[model samples]
Target: MNPSASQNIRPETVAKVRTGIPGFDSISEGGLPRARATLIAGTAGSAKTVFAVHYLAAGITQADEPGVFVTFEDSVADVRKNMLGFGWDIARWEKEGKWAFVDAAPDAEGPIAIVGDYDLGGLLARIEHAVKKIGAKRVSLDSLNALFVQFKDHAMLRAELFRITSTLKRMGVTVVFTGERIDEYGDVTRHGIEEFVADNVVILRNSLEEERRRRTVEILKMRGTTHQRGEFPFTLSSREGIIVIPLSQIQLTQSSSTVRITSGVKELDRMCGGGFFRDSVILASGASGTGKTLLVTQFMSGGFKAKERSLLFAFEESKDQLFRNAAAWGMDFAGMEQKERLMVVNRYPHAMAMEDHLVEMQQIIDDFKPNRVAVDSLSALERVSSLRGFREFVISLTSTLKQKETAGLFTSTSPSLLGGTSVTEKHISTLTDSIILLRYVESFGTMRRALVVLKMRGSQHDDAIREYTIDGKGMHIGDRLSAITGVLSGHTTFEGE
Candidate 1:
């Protein structure tokens, strides 16, 4: 209870062990406290096992430090098979004396039975033996809730876990203990016994929001250390294990350039003070059929014509549709691909979670090293996630694009065909460096299209709502709608009506 006692328990200069989990070490400051036990608690199907396996696998593969995995819930074979998807070859690791398993599952070989106020001396001894045999610097005891379930006395279970953790720490082995939670938002653990033994506590949550499931990890507390607060979104990848998206930890030190890149449309470029910034995110928002895609096509072509690499992620159209549409607009998407000047990736919005989509797309951006990137119709992805999730996705995406120091153009479809604000605009307006609005205007008895440079950060832009026309060639920016008012609100009035 005293500050001096707390300081004595965990010294001010406590060292940390990098967990090797992607993006986790950033949020955890420098990773888990060395030679201390960390509690990973989560509800059913929260990938708790995967997290534990990943922690050890990272140490084994990246640091070449051996690890001991002690399982209490899942069998050793299941753990091995389930982890192969993440490219962790547990069997091979075991053969090379790099990994050891202390299988303590019920009815398994050397199961520890709980009769009355049972001591974990036998299990601890087995764990110590495994650690000694493999020379494991990292150890994981998965799902301690299994032991808690059998032990009715909570106080006794807590005492035993503390003792076990203490013994492991004394061995100078950094440890991880996975526990179970009944509810995603309930106590840290099912039995709430690990709070005393764990030097750090991390919670994994898979919560359902608006018919979509979102997974996030939060480091509740880390003794004698600072960590990023709040839950950070993470996704399970087949190649990599659990990847924590350290959104807050991303540095916004992207270098700004005075140079500008073409917006593909000469008039639009002139309107935008000689084109968009070299490292900026632009949003093209409009109702469907407002030529947002056409604008995007022109933007890409402008870059490709200059021999700059371009990447496009089409969410609302297929490869054929996009290529065909480009052909219709007199753009050669297929030829660009063949020439290796442009890369077009078409993905259905419902294919994966927003987090996965962001991570995968970011990876492609990094790999392709494009000079500019575009996402056609982000509104299509909006229906698949909650507003908050979509906002996070946009923030992360814009930050990534900026960090890449490449120009990014994103399209969003408004729900109203005539005129209206979109959900996407509400969430991503401030995040984007520029906003281009396309609207349909009804003058007299005919429908015409209009364009507006709504907001352009760090540059002077045309504030006039200009009427535009689209034909087989492409969008042609015409004169400003001098006689129209309130074009953005979808309700246009004659100047002197």
Candidate 2:
């Protein structure tokens, strides 16, 4: 390898323009290609129009760049009204000259008659005028499939769209053309428009599995640029439009912090080698009546006692139930919340898809700026999600918690009363920094409870499976059960007489 030759070598890459939709840029490896036509294809009701509107909206609000939106399916008035829900004031942008709409949607005459020897000259002329009128740097021809309905010549339609795309690129305008996906996993373009014009292709899918709606976005191709490949889960938000969750693309470069925080129980803290790491994710797994929720309550109380704000997402219990449970444990959850030291959000396990729940949880975690976050029994969420969705949720939640450096304690419920692993634990056990297992032990016709620090990364922890009791004052940790074995396996055996 010659030094001079190595110095002259450069990576081949495409310059990108940020799309402004959240989470899209990270997977796109920056943004969409600049001065190129990218096809946004999706089925009906998959938020294709919203994605286009949000892209141009992002340019105007984020970069002060003007845009032209050519609607071929929905009317301009309808678009202005529909986008208001996402809080995009398209009307205001139009008045400010930051946006121009080429109303190409078919009226009673069917989309301007393909004007002048069937060449798309009239519509193309309108688009060119709108671009020059606003000095636009971005253009979106939404739902180009509608134009196919008006004009039956598939070969000619592709040629005309390509010509329009070429003209836009020559003007240095970054472009997005939305098309309809005939099937969720079908070909990229139904009319083969992308084959001629698109320098990049993006596909959006709203798939239904087990009666649950799961939305995803994939960068099928980026001609001159590199991008993370795969179908990343995404969801539509009322505030920000489409948000893609790049689960596999999230970098595993979180910094490890030596600082420890209490697990809210003193003996438990000592057992975990001082306490849980500040940026660590801890999983507490046990069966019903095993004090899993009690542990979550204590964890939050401990943070509140330390003058640190703690946030708890309760999927298995209501706010009132949690408050009552905390009160029974000699803790004041309501009082802590009153002082703003704690924020408890309770939601049903089946409320939304895994991605939607992830977005909401991240927003709350960021807004609260909590020092600790706890999810009461992730098994509740797991029961309602598919195996893949559950795993994605757990990984995403763990990554976000680590990135924010917020201590997270997630609880999981075991299926068996004695000894068994839950599906939730199997998916997230490796991602967590520590694992605390609570199990039931049968001793001479009596049922007893035990707790153990099963695994702790980066520090020494007590391996003893010690007996624990729950009374009015909360869990009391005791000496290790030395004479008994197999405490974790739930089938206890006496070692010596």
Candidate 3:
């Protein structure tokens, strides 16, 4: 047999170890550098310990890789019990020889001191024994600050820290060392040496903003690899260990569909040049009580009638309210839901952070895999997020929906009751593929609803402002209001008057 030339080719890539934390791998461009030491630093209650533990647990459960946790602050029993609270059965894993704990905490009654002549050889030996016993591929040294506190001399502390990190790297095990930040605003550790000695540095922060505590994670440095910059919001829960939401890292190059889908309303579809393109984003902006929610319901109901799956994410309206409102217009939302063709999810915007809301939405979309998705109002989401954050959210969300090839409709409340542009409208106009405007027009002394297709990319749309009515049969689009002049400016005068 002749030797193949492909057998000797070497990959020109740096090896990485998956942390298994949600969004963490994506932000890190893969994961932490393999067989390298990473320093996780943060202040009290910043979840440094939990993050390290989750990494070890994930390695064992998801990668089929054994791990060893060397704790200097918590005992083995304490660590196991605490992990159990997060539904991680570390004790069971230990029994199965898939995980092991090396307790390095000082005895409560014993005087603890690292004499100037002493080295970390004893600790190193213990770690080596545990790793060899379990054939561990991952390790975590919790609270390296605890060891620093025992040492009096700075030189000795730095030497010991460097020695520990170097030895762990030589052991060929991916390692994480937790350290307490000196202050809230700085990434330096208590001894200010851990950051310089480790191959990777991740800082977790829990700070007070607007009288509320927000948790964030940042990759301060990752040697030999590129990583996502800026701070990303993260959440910790009992069931889900750590979830990092990287808003800036969301890719915008989602695949778009050229196929057009119906708008459900025949006249409206005609105005939009047949229908909207599949995987396109449509922004329906209007004033309060201008039937924005009704339009969304119609869009969703249209999907249901076509036997296409739909998901409605209602922020301001309750599920019952949505059902009743749809029923008033002769649409059976509850029936559609019963048939599993529709999914209505109601959320209180103020109850959670904007990042958390986005994460939840992504999870639901992934699980339901709906053909059509609607967010009743983006104004509520805008209110929950800062201006910059809202813009980022909309871009990230619309891009994701397009990537999934799902048609998306987002409703926004205009500040003006009459025809006028809003800041939000201006910001999102460029991000969306189409824009539909609904306004209130006053003719003589009567108030009426008017609709217009302001912009539809790559398609011809009706330019005239048509009067619409929401009655028992839902929105009825009449002929263009040609007899009325200045309708867009709130006051409309009859053409011949």
Candidate 4:
């Protein structure tokens, strides 16, 4: 095909500020707008200041763009001290004349020249001096709340915000102004100072639920470029600085190795679509003695055999009891742990805070980069946290697993009281990507277990509920129980048709 007339016109690439957030620039379609003021608004402790400082740090280290950080929340020394977590030597950077820190409150007492008889000229002149001194290209005001303390009227604060942004933009200085957001899940705050003035708006929100807390960053608006619109999960570490884990971005490499994992039962793999999906989440639910733990052991060992790392988080069983019981079923978890491919985490339901568990889980993932993760039963986690918290926990777990492309096989013990269908089952079923129910069906005067697929998103499987059996070797799906009378009564009488 010949090049069209429009194709002949090549567009120039616009300059952007590299924000230093891992996987973030990709979400922004490159980076933040250049020479424009961007508002990073959030409540206290939401890491807004850290993000702003890290952005400036990236400008200094990656782009060689000198930066000026004007703080209202912390002193220059305190700012430097806090940045130590990122392994950034603020003193070294300052000494090199590539960065400058200014405390706004200290300079406010000076005899100042008011720009146009309304603006803060002293602050502007100080900023200009710092910019010219080090050829700084970027600036960040720690927070606008501190800047607003002097102003009693809302109208004046908004005007001043506009003037400051305009002055910085005119100087070709890309700036980030951190502000406090009072309202959540909405545009701007009550003051509306940042919502109207800045060229770009970025919101960082910390959503607290009964089970977990999530930190997210969203680009509300970017003036001249296309950006991703999603609440991307972000994390700040003592070493990694800031990173955003985007969910939809699939990092599939050029390889389809048909990565096989043992499904605890050899026959169960044949029943499933050739083993559980690599890096997928599997929900296994059943009544007691359905061999959920045994099946999980087999799955974990499969990962070990494949030389891929895996973790088993047991909420109900003690490590010793699990080893002893699983040994009887031919699962050698202790042996796998010795090989360093498998890790067994045993925690009581009431022992640890749910938040600490999340942090620990992430740390393990970061350290191991495991191919498989198993939570023996989420019901234990649910017991410790509130319903809202449990939802957040599920979201966090799913989000993390998806982002890392790690397979997670979890169990949720369904009470026999509710049978195969009930509100409790429905609640958990809605949260998982796939649901596999194991239940006891009374047939021929005997209690038998059955396996059924409640749902499997993005894949098709058998719809029939089949008979399942557990023996010394492990769990297996048997032929459907065909002969039974009054099976729903929790008791069965056999009769020929």
Candidate 5:
């Protein structure tokens, strides 16, 4: 007798089981394959057990699906206590009959001796009973290597793995098996055969980059579905569990805004072809004391004045200091914040990783839903990440803001004090929709401020460098400084000299 056509259909067409972890489903191209075994491998302290617990917790809470967690390393009570720290009341879930645990950890008193030929039949039986008891749709066998370490024969270990995985698949329960990677860069599992037996494999890495610990996740293999194929940054937080930052998957679809938004300084707005597009990214680049932060403040203040919500990420200043500086220029930043029109987030650059900063910004943008955002200074962030990483982050951040139709203004500090040039100008200039240069011109034996629009991708802008003044009333753009040549180069000379 032949099987039905549906039986021969590819597994990819089957519906996926959503993991309910933030950003996990999106990066997995939905979620884990249904009714299949997935191997979660990592080194010590890599949060492998924590990841498994989260998977089960999410299934029980969000998917209305009962789950069974079979731990071979930690006791059921210990697992419960650890999960409680993460705000997951696994004990309560057990009482509600939504989840169950199989404690197969070796007794602390002594090791069990198995003299006869053995298989995982007893463990499989316990799992089957738990599934039948709670009607579980999800299962996790954490630290699968704990059971393998007991057997000396590699063939027996592989056979037991195949049996357990095949039995779980026949039960029609989506399963996750946590294993420890033996070498720093070797097989996904210590035994080297689990990865081959599992339907999917996800490797979690916690490595030091520049003496800072970085956590990343990569899908090594997936049998039926196409998953994102790069190592993406992830964070394990007490409140949100495993949150992945899928920066590599960001789409670059250009989202345009026909409406032009003011830059607060009326003359500067006029110079940018009547202000900036609503969803554009503007780079305000200059050296130290060139008023880059002030330009960002004015742009944010303009959004506040227009009744549009604004967010300011201050890397170098506190909220109070930013408010004081804005107040010096006649802008009431505190009042705007009090009115809920503005929000200022201050974070020291050294306090967190670049990926952490990206996650923070993503959360704030989601919660605040601001119409405008300003990052007062990318140079601080560059100090924390690699050049390539920084560029990727800028691209991801700007692309996300553009997709949300949020106008973003970012400040970059030129290394030279006399406006020699900026590395950021060469690197990030293409990612932005417009480039606004703030510089100091050395003309007539004195230093004077100048402003110019170097590039605006989709709009015409004034090419002439205009002199500007910063005072109690904020930036004031005067007539174009057509008399000075090399204004951008700091060594300016009279045009007719």
Candidate 6:
């Protein structure tokens, strides 16, 4: 493939209903078919309603396609209020006769609303009334589950599902029908009748795994179209609405070739291959007082010198305190801030949610377009909240860095609670693109720190754990200390002469 073609956005050649959600249409390989029905199934809290509302709103705003929202669960006013996150004034559209809402809650009750009593005819008439009144081209049924009360039998509901979906398709109105799906156990809230009815099935799932709740989406099937089939992570915010940071788009790009960070100490950069690679993630882990701070600060300073913007989110120290400490080491801190190349974000553990911190960091990244980002000490992040929340925060933070092609350097305090190579927080290690272990070893009644490059994706790094130090002149690295052992265990032994 040509290198430049990787970032290209070739517009799709199809009559489609564009769901204006960011990173959404691109993943669908374009957009939903113009006059077809797409099923959105997921357990509650999977954002099935939010997804349905956003699709309708996006069509009204982006495609200029008038829309009708048929609600079986909530009232029209309730649905509109729920969608306030999209920054949409739905009432204005309704007033303009370009959109309409129909409540099916009453029809979904004791009386059978299947064929003639309160059936497809009445529903179709209401939809047509709304469409012709305002020239609407898109529709969203809040749920297909409500029909179960009206159509008691599986075979009967299945027929009604087909009838409703087919009627909308034949009317040339793009439709999104919301439903629910069973989990990995196939134990759904109900049968899969609704899933089998729609032409395209997209499942959204959110679950608690290992103390963390994550959201993922997959396309079960999309008839007559080739769609990428995988459950990718996504976030829905009040500001950006719904966004899925496609990992598929994160291939190493040539544009990131020239970015670099300064080793906190000059000699340290020479020990490692050239400074850290652009857009790469580097993990700096060590026990207390191993010069990890000096190394990371040097990297931050390097970014400042190059006039590349950077963010320093420190949990271990205040901005003034870090500056004072750096000054003691003879590192230039005041000079860099004068040049406007660096910005520090200091926060305490109890202030907010890990998710909130990620959101705030994302805003700063988007505003500054920084090339370097540093989160000093992953251990500090752990101190704030639940393990799962921290993992989600890390995932969101790292994923944002890769998307923006920013070189991220994170420090972690290790030598674990049990004092061995085993890490209680394995999620941090798994998410990092590279791992640099720092250990303080006791040798002959003296304390010394060692540095080792454990892992680096897409780039080779030296594997030796060399002796390193920090004094008034800043950090320094010496040749590999072959005489020492037990460095990883936090205890050291040397060969006797």
Q: Show where candidate 6 strays beyond 4 Å.
A: 1-18, 96-98, 105-118, 150-161, 181-196, 252-260, 315-340, 346-363, 379-403, 417-435, 453-466, 472-474, 478-491
* RMSD of each predicted structure: 4.0, 3.2, 3.7, 5.6, 3.6, 5.1
Query: Could you give candidate 3's per-residue lDDT for residues 1-497 as a string of tens digits?
Result: 11321232554255778788888987887788888989999998999999999999989888899999999998888889988988899989999999988888877778664444877788888898999999999999898888777666668767877787787788898989899986778646887866457888899998876555678899989987778998887877666688887777776643356687877777888998888888888999999999989989999999988889999999989999999999999999989999999999999988887666776788889999999999988988877776766776788788779879999999998898877776678788888888898989887678888899988887778898899998997998998898888766665678778
Model 5, 1-497: lDDT tens digits are: 11322343554465678899877777887788888998989999888998899999999879899999998999998999988988999989999999999888987878778788877788878989999999999999888778777667678777877887787789899999888996547867777866456889998998887777788888888786778888887877767678887776677654377789998778888888889888889899999988998898898899988999999999988888899999999899989999999999999888877767877787899899999999988888888877766876798789779878999999988888776667776888888888888888887678888888998877788898888888998888888887878777766678667
Estimate every model's Cα lDDT from 0 to 1.
Answer: 0.88, 0.89, 0.84, 0.73, 0.84, 0.72
Residue 468 lDDT in candidate 4: 70
Candidate 4 Cα lDDT to native: 0.73
TM-score of every prediction relative to native: 0.93, 0.96, 0.91, 0.76, 0.93, 0.79
Kindly give the stretch of ten consecutive residues in candidate 1 with the minimal lDDT sum: 1-10
- TM-score for candidate 5, please give it: 0.93
lDDT of 6 by residue, 50-82 (tens): 888788778877878888888888777777787
Candidate 2 to native Cα RMSD, angstroms: 3.2
Q: Kindly list the per-residue Cα lDDT of model 2 for residues 1-497, writing each as its tens digit.
A: 22322332465456778787888988997788889999999988888999899999999998899999999899999999999999999999999999999998888663444444567888889999999999999999899999888888878888889889999999999999899888998888687778898999999999997878999899999997778898999988887888999887775544399999999999999998899999999999999999999999999999998999999999988899999999998999989999999999999888888888999998888799999999997999988898889888988888898888899999999999999888788888888888999999999988999999989888999999899999998989999999898888776799874
Pairs that collide in candidate 3 are: none
By TM-score, how accurate is candidate 1?
Answer: 0.93
Estimate the lDDT of model 5: 0.84
- Candidate 5 residues lying further than 4 Å off, grouped into runs, are 1-14
Count residue pairs with overlapping backbones in model 2.
0
On a 0 to 1 TM-score scale, where does candidate 3 land against the true structure?
A: 0.91
